[model samples]
Target: MAPEAEPRQPPVDPRLWRYAAASRSFFLVIALLSLAQTAAIVGFAFFTTRAIVDAIAGDDLTGTLAALTGVVVARALLSLVRERVAARASARVESQLRGAVLDGIARLGPGWTATRSTSHLALVAGRGLDALEPYVGRYLPQLVQTVIATPLLIAAMWQADAISGLTVLLTLPLIPIFMILIGLATRSVQRRQWETLSRLATRFSETVQGLSTLTVFGRQRRAADAIERVTDDYRRETMTVLRVSFLSGFALEFLASISVAIVAVAVGFRLIDGSLTLSVGLFVLLLAPEAFLPIRQVGVQFHASSEGVAATRDVFAVLDAAAAASAPPAQAAAPAQGADHRLRLEGVRVRDLPPVDLEARSGEIVLVEGPSGAGKSSLLQALLGFASATGRIEFDGADAASRPPSTWLAWAGQRPGLASGTIAANISLGDDDMPAETIQQALALVGLADVDPYRMLGVQGAGLSGGQAQRVAVARALARHLRGHAPVLALDEPSAALDAAAEQHLWQSLRTVADAGALILLVSHRESARTIADRVVRLNSAEVTA
Candidate 1:
């Protein structure tokens, strides 16, 4: 499935100029190479035509052939240079744009992105952005040629023979007129295709995530029906795009064919009357094809790049929203702090959940317990600033909103997203400076003494038992706890998958954390987990809901 299209804009959106400018040095080289290629095309035509006339007249051919060969070699070298520069520029621009989109997602926080399905975002970032390669590598260079080479050829043709030049000049505008009409006809369909693909991807991802639940509920057949409907829609839309593409190609080719034929016919008559020499006539004849080359290529490249153009629109929208969210309202500032290390929440409300009031100091395990759908997790989410609530959360001596998540929270989820790798790497994901000794200590704390630090684990801890997987998750939290000062350990069902023995060991690990003066927030329903908490706060399932 594909991602949804952003609002319609130009094929090359204005927001993309920043990325283009970042690769300006490479683009500059490409431009220079294009200029040289244009010159070689002109020189190539002149020499080849001169060689033909010399052959017809029984004159010397060495100089004309030699010049033609030199021009061919020069054109080949310039083409190679152009390709290399475009490739580099393509890579650089793609990297910058992908980085921007990912960074915006990071800044906006998980809560916002969670509104879209996992598969949709992944597709947009991966394959959708990849479609831009042709846009940069092939289309952009042809656009530059159309801007530079086309005019030069027309001027040269006119200088050598006025009638031939007049015919070409009169017909040139028709090519773009056809291109514009094609674009107009296909724009809405292309946008709809992009959007439908995104919806299909999003729905598939959602179904996969809930497949077990669907199977249990005996609704898998219905899910299958929904998917089939989406696929059929996508197929229909794809056919429409192909139909338009064929029509566009046929129209451009027909126009170019007629225009070139007119030039050839006019030049032939001039040569017959002795008003134009054969060399000059052949020269103008050759130049006719070159004049239409760039415009035709531009139309093809434009069609190839439609998918990327749609994705860029969505990427830019995300970037714009992230920039807006970076600064909160003036009234949202937190009140000054009073305690050394304390977390206080007052009248905090998220969605339909009842207002919550809570307070805790450092050096304690504060357990948050409740029935399903009681908004226990929502409380933690609110503290993480992922949910909008009408309340104040003060950490240390300042407002929690004033600081980023890294400064105050160490979170481990119910389903730990442990990447496929060695145990040590999972423990210290992306934080290379974290010492091996620290990771080992974290593992030992969670009672995994025998697990080798470098042992291979399948994707998301596939090879590990349920208990060991949970322990790895706890170790991740502990590793984070060890690194940050004045941090809170926030765990959601950390012992849900563990056996009695493993659960006890995990509880003991939490006790050790609480005893060491770290503030901890544990969300669990098990008696073993509740037993280890310094203070247990259990709300009735009916008390609140989000």
Candidate 2:
């Protein structure tokens, strides 16, 4: 099958203005600066032409020379101001867009992210958005200058001498036409370069994550070769983009130089025939290049900022998807108040899974039991609002979607989700000012009383063994419940890595919490879990039975 074509994108994306307020302000500032710069260009050219003609006529030239010098200085100052504004705008707009992308991802939830590549998202958020600096700084200002200055300068030239103005009007369209052709080629190679970079990131992340497995299977060399191949491809793609950029720059310069030369030739002949005065001829000759400057620079800068353009396209896709997903906005389920938290799921279905109906209130131990292929984990995900499903889920008589799960639910998944932090910090991840006593109690409940709470850990709890990490995760969930921060605790195979004694101890600890009025939702395949459960909810082939 042929590869799908990329979508056509506009030069200035409207979404940037909608999502980032800074872009709108930047445009306003740039327009004002562009107007001042245009005035300076006209004044400088007129004064310089006047100075030359006056000198030939042997007129005193102090005033014209002074005015010309001032215009030159003003022009330089304006350029500096434009640069500062563009730099600030680039930083602000990049920050705004990055924040919006992150918020969009949050609104889309974990299920949306699970289907996408994490490395690709990281690229978009990190390096991809950073590429926007040149686009916002140099390209956008030049584009705005072209819009504001080009026509005004052309009119000035026309007022001075119509033949030169007419010649410029005819030739300016050619630059854009050439630019369009070159841009098509440039975008193709830049896109390949971007995709190859994403692939390299994904490959490296995968390799690092599974390095041991690859080594055991004797596939490490092959994985390294694959990464090398992608790197080479990326390097080639980059070279191709650079080649196109240089060629386009040369083409634009050549066109602009030729157009100005034509205007100069016409002005020279008119000056000789005495149809145009010396002042008029010189003024038009000078303004001719000024008229073409902005447009040519715009063409050049467009190639420079092409990477940012591609990145913005990806950013906008995420923002658009999130907007579509949350049309009219989502009112999460209200938190259950003052004890008596009740979770009710009515015909709740996750993906293609069969509907699940369950009602559990505070102080109950509800165990989720099922075979391997059953939607046991999916059901927990539904309650956590990570997965999309068609169903009515309520907590304390309010729509469950109206509130976040963190307000009422504490969960420990199969993976510990530990970061590089002290044990106390990991256990009380979301809670603030957790007492040392409380952390100690939580550790003891999970059979880790001997472990020091203040001891630091490496990435992903690297200092701990498998069973220790699992118990630490459980303690984290239990710590939240113990602090009364959440009324319900959800653990998926909390004791999977624990030995029999540790497993039994963890179950007894859970029973004690439930007896003290905390609702527990446990998913386990082991038979020992049945001893402490108040109810067993079995799932098989997506269907749930109590």
Error of 1 at 276 (Å): 6.0
Best by TM-score: 2
- Can you write out model 1's per-residue Cα lDDT over 1-546, one digit (the tens) per residue? 897754446645656776446556655676787788889999999998998988989999998898899999999988887887788788888888788778877877876776766676777777777877887788778888788988888999999988888898899999999998898767767777888898899889888889999999999999989999999998998889888988898999999999999888888887899998888899999899999988998888877876776677666777677666565445434322222368888887778877777888878788888888777888888777677778888876467776566556777878788889898889888578989888889999999978898998998888898878888988887887786622687888988888888888888878987787678899999977767888887766446321
Model 2 local distance difference test score: 0.90
TM-score for each predicted model, relative to the true structure: 0.70, 0.74
Give stretches of model 2 more than 4 Å off: 1-3, 102-109, 322-378, 385-536, 540-543
Q: What TM-score does prediction 2 earn?
A: 0.74
lDDT of 2 by residue, 1-546 (tens): 999988887779899899889999899999999999999999999999999999999999999999999999999999999999999999999999999999988887897788788999999999999999999999989999999999999999988888888999999999999989998898888988888889999999999999999999999999999999999998998999899999999999999999999999888888789898899988998899999999999988999898998788788889988777665324343334337788898998888877889999888999999888688888889888787788898877777665566777889999999999899999989777888899999999999999999999999999999999999999999888877778889999998999999999999999999988888999999999999999999998846899
Per-candidate RMSD, Å: 6.5, 5.7
Candidate 1, residue 122: lDDT: 76
